[model samples]
Target: MANLDAPATAIIGCGNINRGDDGAGPAVIARLAAEDLPSDVELLDAGTDGMAVMYRARGAQQLIVIDAREPEGKPGAIYEVPGDVLAAEPVHGVGLHAFRWDNALFVGRKIFGDDFPSDVQVYLIEAQTLDYATELSGPVVAAVEKVAAKIAARLVIAPEA
Candidate 1:
């Protein structure tokens, strides 16, 4: 049970629906829309607006962002990382978007100040394909559901007395 009334918790999912697995982020976010969340949480469908995601995260006590990442792991694999860890991790090569998650963290710092919220977290799901004009493949659709559950679990809040 986490505090849900401190600030808005934003879940930003980015991707191109026309593309293949690149749409994983957006797909997960879409699934979340069907659920009933605490009034303190906000879910945004920020397609490719990695930087803009930070704007929505300002003043949040806990911010959980969900995106698709290509890590050295199995496809559909999900990674849950603290926002600080994602921010501190160095960039070794080109990322999905020019900014990517690193940029999002940086923007978060700039917008909310250096020690930006302590509860920020990222939920990254491994992506299989990034085709520009294809719909999400079969595996990704299933993966989105799993990721959605993970996101919900993370956002869960206990009732206040």
Candidate 2:
């Protein structure tokens, strides 16, 4: 059960805002910014920096991340992913951007030890056009609002997790 008196929940949005549908995270951030959130809830629009994600997730007890996932489905198909699922996937990359939420968790665990949040949820929005575009695709635009609302309902307005 969550300690009502010391609830530390953080909602982080991760993606490149300039890349078409890849901008889903920032879009969700935009929506959540318009709402009145609880004082205990922190919202971070962490662009493609995995280190930033790890740093921000350190102190929170519950963390929710929103991002545009690798191509896996039709655009706007939202997937609610657990941290373990990402950890199970093989990580192949040269630099920081290659490490995503799972990597963030791994780093956090190594550095912060018990201080890192164990409850982590990643909301993935499939992309259609992740090209050099600033605006989100038609489907991803709709999906952003849906995701933003659903996350808000689950974490912010709802009684508990």
User: What's the lDDT for all of these models?
Assistant: 0.72, 0.81
What is the per-residue lDDT of model 2 for residues 47-84, given as tens digits with 9 covering 90 to 100? 88877777887778888889997666688999998875
Q: Write down the lDDT that model 2 would get.
A: 0.81
Residue pairs of candidate 2 with colliding backbone atoms: none
Q: State which candidate has the highest lDDT.
A: 2
Regions of model 1 farther than 4 Å from truth: 1-7, 71-73, 89-97
lDDT of 1 by residue, 1-161 (tens): 22233356777787777767777888888899998877777788888776666666666666777777763447777788877877753356435467665576766676568335567778777777776766766666778999898778867887789
Residue range with the least summed lDDT across 10 consecutive positions in model 1: 1-10
- TM-scores of all candidate predictions against the true structure: 0.80, 0.85
* Cand. 2 TM to true fold: 0.85
| Ten contiguous residues minimizing lDDT sum, candidate 2 | 88-97
Error of 2 at 125 (Å): 0.3
